[model samples]
Structure formats: structure tokens, C-alpha cells
Target chain A: MKNSPTKNQISSYIIQSQEEEIKRIALELHEGVGQTLYSLYSGLQFIEQTINSSNMKSYVNEMSQLLEKTIQEIRLLSVELHPPTLTTLGLVPAMKSYLRMFTSTYGILVDLDIEGQEPNLTETQKITLFRVCQEALGNVAKYADTHFIQLDFLFVDNNLTMTINDNGKGFTVENEMQRSSGLAAMKERMNLIGGQCLITSEIGKGTTIDVLLPL
Target chain B: MVMDNLYNQTYMKQACEQLQGTIECDFVGLAFQESKGPNIGWKYASGNSNDKYERITLRYGKGIAGRVLSTGRPMEIKYFPQNILGKALEYPIMLAEKLLYAYAVPILINGIPKGVLLVGFRSETSISDDEKKFVEKAAADIKKFLSLEKM
Candidate 1:
């Protein structure tokens, strides 16, 4: 007799499908709406130069400006939804690009320190790590009230470890773990990939998240 | 370009201070979309307890400033964290400034909303109609200044 899938397996499948859906939407937003808006902006510029009346030219200019803003917004949304670099250039580059955008958006600087050579990683492992980091950084931005963060990536023999530390107002780990679905999801994602996530915090000191994966 | 940005910053600071004085509010903040990017951030603030406002950046419809920019309208919250549509965390400005009441109006440039001017009160108080008008006037002045600077 065939065995039924476990709860963890079902949730893992759901998370995988969700990621695939997000990737598809991100691609559509980038290539479809984003490109169309760019062309619209160009067309407006062309019309602006040909128009003889100053009033008409000004109106065209404003339209172009609005279009430009929309294009930028769509571009950012697409990247935030699913960074193309993660698939193309691999984890480190993708993380760097994401950190840059995160700093620009939140004005919180993340100091990344890498140790040892990067080991070969499966696609699932790479994506899982990326998603976990993204979720962790988002929490830091929302609740940390911090201006600075430290992310350390360490690679040892057949093992990879990542540590994220924030020097901001912390909370009780037990209470927050129950209250935050994001934290739960992070742990679930790591567990699906045979990894462990540990979170520790103090009220006045800070919070630290450690993720360990064995290859 | 650098000089123009500096000029805008100085002007915005002065305008925020003027508005805070006239409106008798505890804080006044000006958030603007970057000229080269889509990020909207609080660039200037008056009566700010800390520099935390400068660290906040929102997308099109996330926070108070973002909502005002997207909707192109004025928004007023008399009792914050209560009767609000979403989570209190969504209003970063209110949380950062510890404000109980806030009024935000869009700064329209060429009929396009490109910025937000917000006034907040730490203590619970209803904003008078005259005070609302002052905020609107301040937003108009910022719109005018930005439009002229573009040329």
C-alpha cells in the first residue's frame, strides 16, 4: 500500500508552488508591464519634442515623468518579488544585490562577512537560504528599530552556517516565536531542507538568528 | 544637481519648521520620491525627537506618506492605533514620532502627486479647520517650489 504524505511534506509542496507562482508573476511584471511603460515614456518624450505649444510640451513632460516613476516602481517590485540574480549568478551575488537594495530602501546598513570558500549547493538549498535571509532581514527592519546589522556566512567541511545579528530593541524569544508567523515559516523552510534555525533574544540587548545546513 | 538638492533640503527644512510653528503641532515631516528612483523617504522633519525619520522608506501604498502619494488626497487620523484600517506598524512616521494624531496631504507637482507633507500631534487633539488649511497651504508651497526647481 502507498503511504500518505506527512503534514511537513504537504506544507513543503505548498511553499514550493508558492515560490514558483511568485517567480512567474515577477517575470511577467518585469517583461510585460515594465517594458510597456518604458516604451510609453519614450513615446511621450518623442511627442514632447515634436509639440510646438509650450503648454502641450509641459503636459507631455509630466506624463513622461509619471511614466518614468511607474517604470521604476515596477522594476523594484519585480526584483523584490523574485530576484533574477539568485537563479542566474548564484547565492552570494544575489545576496549582495538584495542587501544593497535593502539598505537603500530601509537605510539600515548590513555588514556581510564571509569566511572560507563557497561550497557547491543544490538549487533548493540556495533558494531556501536566500528566502530565509530575506525573511530575517525583513523582520529586522520592521521590529528591530536598528540602524545596523551584521550577517556572517561561514563555510566549513560539508557544512554551511549563517548568522544574523541586530543591535536593536529585542523581545522575548518564546513570545515572539508564537506571535510571528514569519519566524515559524522560516523554521519550516529550514526544516524542509534538513537545516536548523535558532533564534535567541533578550529584552534590552539584541536578537540573533543562526542557520546551519549540512551538505 | 548637487547644489539643487542642497537648496531643496534647506527649503524643505524651513518650510517644515514654518508649518510646525503655524499649525502648533509637535512634528512636521516632508517625504518625497527620489528624483532618480521610486523610493519615497522622509527627507525633512521639524521637532523630531530623533533622526529615525530619515531611515524610513516606503513603496507606493505601504505607510502614511505612501498612501497619500498613491491616493493623491489628504488623510487625517485623530486617534492612532485605534480605528485605523491596518496594523499600527504600517504607520512608521506615527510610531517613530510617537504621535497620537496626524494629518497628511499630497504635494502635487504639475497635477501629479509626488510628495507628502505631514503634521502630527503627540497629545490627543482634534485638528481645527484652520489648522488643516495651514497644512494644505504648506503642501502647495512645496509643490510650487519643486515645480519651479524642475525648470
Candidate 2:
């Protein structure tokens, strides 16, 4: 308590504290709420197996639908807290899963192109790249009014490059950065791993975000 | 609630207006997620004339909308033909839409990307750093709400 100052230092400490708190809540959602939901889902499945009636099955199906939705919500909450895929599987798999989910949810076509061989990246690098792409995709969903978006990954030698391009109502890049923090956050996250992020776009055209990292 | 409907419309409207206001450009639209993807690219003409941009189906990586739909990221550019790569010019959303300067961002959730949010300026005004930050923040906020709705 004594170490926490009210001005710059305390503010940073408070922010850190806040992030930790969010993480804790996320963890709780995973451990407590997620488990409870999973239990409920399993119990419903058991009941679904025991009962046999075509008409009753239809009603059960409705209940199952609601349960499925609840399960999906719980899964999303857990993922939002801390993605297990990122921890167990690596960034590539996590990204692929995320892309598939994106296409299904938004009814958008996602063309994912992976070029060259992908080497094993450090956990830090993988997480950094994942977060950068995550944020980049976030921008696209919230902003780009386009039907198609492409995420391209190229690994040439020791350098890795990721390009996210979209064709929507394009705005001035300068003004976007001034008004929006998503781009800056993406750049900052990439910069942490000694990478660079670039954005290019046009009006009535589209926008593209390029991120480069050294392997 | 009236506020809820108003809020939704306002949100959609503001998304278009922000693009119009920031870039000092005309023509704003929103292509939401449809069963068959963003169908019939509706030119959200809150500020511009409702002339000819209503009947369009955007493909992935072909036009401006298609590219954003495919990539799930933000974009910005000044000169269209001069700056656009020649080989990737088959898409008509850019030229057909008549966008000059442009910026777009993806609305994402839980480390996943959904749809895209876009803004455009018909002129060659340089997009500053601050503008990008604001757009990104707005996109994130919107995505959060969308995710909540999903839940």
C-alpha cells in the first residue's frame, strides 16, 4: 500500500491490478461457471439419451438448443479469459480455430493462406503474434464493411509476415489512428516482440494491415 | 425499449457518420453478416445520395468490401489506382464504390474476428495516428457488445 503512489506510478499499478482482476474473474468464470455449465450440459445429454419420443425428442431438441447456446457462451467466456488453445496447441492452430469460428459467426468468407514452413516460435512470440492478429481481426469485424477478408501468413527464412486485408469503405489512415486506438494497440503489441505493423487503405477501396516479426 | 432500438440504430448510424466525419468524405455503408455472407452490399446513405450503391454483392478479396471480408483487418490508402497493386485490382468494390481515401477495421471477439467496420473519405486526406486509435477503440467496443448479444 505504501509503495502505491497516487500519480503515475499508482495509476500504472492500478491498471496492472485491474488487468489482474479481470484475469481472476475470467479464471473464475472458467473454473466455477464453466464447470457448472459443462455439468448441466452432460446431465441434459444423459436425459436426452434416456428419453425416447419423437415428439418429446423435438421438445428435448429445443431444450438442447438452449443448452447448446449456453455451452457456447460459457466456452466463449472461458476463451476470452485465457484461451486454452493458445496454451496447449500453438498460435497457428489457435488462429485457425478462431478463423473458422469467425466465418461461421459472421457469415463471412475467410481465405487463410499459409506460405513457407512455420518454425517453432517462442511462447512470447506466438502470443504476441496471436494478440496482434486478434486485434487486427477485431478491427475488421467492427469497421470494415466488406464481404471478404483475407489473412495471409508468410514465413521466409527467419522472418514472418502477416497481412490482413479488407475491402470496405476505406478512410484516411492518419485520421483513423488519431481517432481509433485499435491500430495503435496492434502496433504496440507487435513492437513488444521487435516487430512492425503497417496499415494501408483507401476510400471506397479497402484497408490492409501488415505485421512483420523476426523468427 | 425505445432506447435499445435507438441505440442500435444510433450505433449503426454513428459507425457510418464517424467515417464520414473523420475523413471528410461522402458515401457510408454497412454490410452486416448474412447467412450467405454480406449480401447485397447496402450503401448506408445516411449522408450521401441514395443513387446506385444499393445493389451489390461483395466477394472476398475482389473488391474493397470483399477484401475486408476476407482479411478481417483494418485498411487505409490515399490514391486508389496509383497505390493499389495492379494484380489485385479485379475487385470492383473499390472502383465501383468510388472510394478515394479509405480506412477499415475488423470487429473481433474473444481473439476471433467476425465482420468488418469501415469508414471512407472521398479525398486524399492523410489519416493521422489518432484517427486509427479511435477507430480501433470503437470497433472493440462494438465487438464487445456483439459478443454480449451472442452470449
Give the best candidate by lDDT: 1
Compute the lDDT of residue A131 as modeled in candidate 2: 69
Query: lDDT per residue, candidate 1, B1-151, as tens digits?
Result: 2113677779889999999998888999988876565567888899987676787776566567768887899999878878987766567777667788999999887677878899999899868988899899889988777778778
The parts of candidate 2 lying over 4 Å away from their true place are A1-32, A48-61, B1-151
Report the alpha-carbon TM-score of model 2 versus the true structure: 0.52
Considering every candidate listed, which one attains the maximal DockQ?
1
Fraction of the real A/B interface contacts present in each candidate?
Answer: 0.30, 0.00
Model 1: lDDT to the true structure: 0.83
Clash count, one per candidate: 0, 88
Residue-level lDDT for A145 in candidate 2: 63
Q: Assess each prediction's global lDDT (C-alpha) against the native.
A: 0.83, 0.64
Rate residue A105 of model 1 by lDDT.
Answer: 64
lDDT of 1 at A168: 80
Listed per prediction, chain B TM-scores read 0.93, 0.73
Model 2 has a DockQ score of 0.03
- In model 2, what is the error at residue A41, expressed in angstroms? 2.2
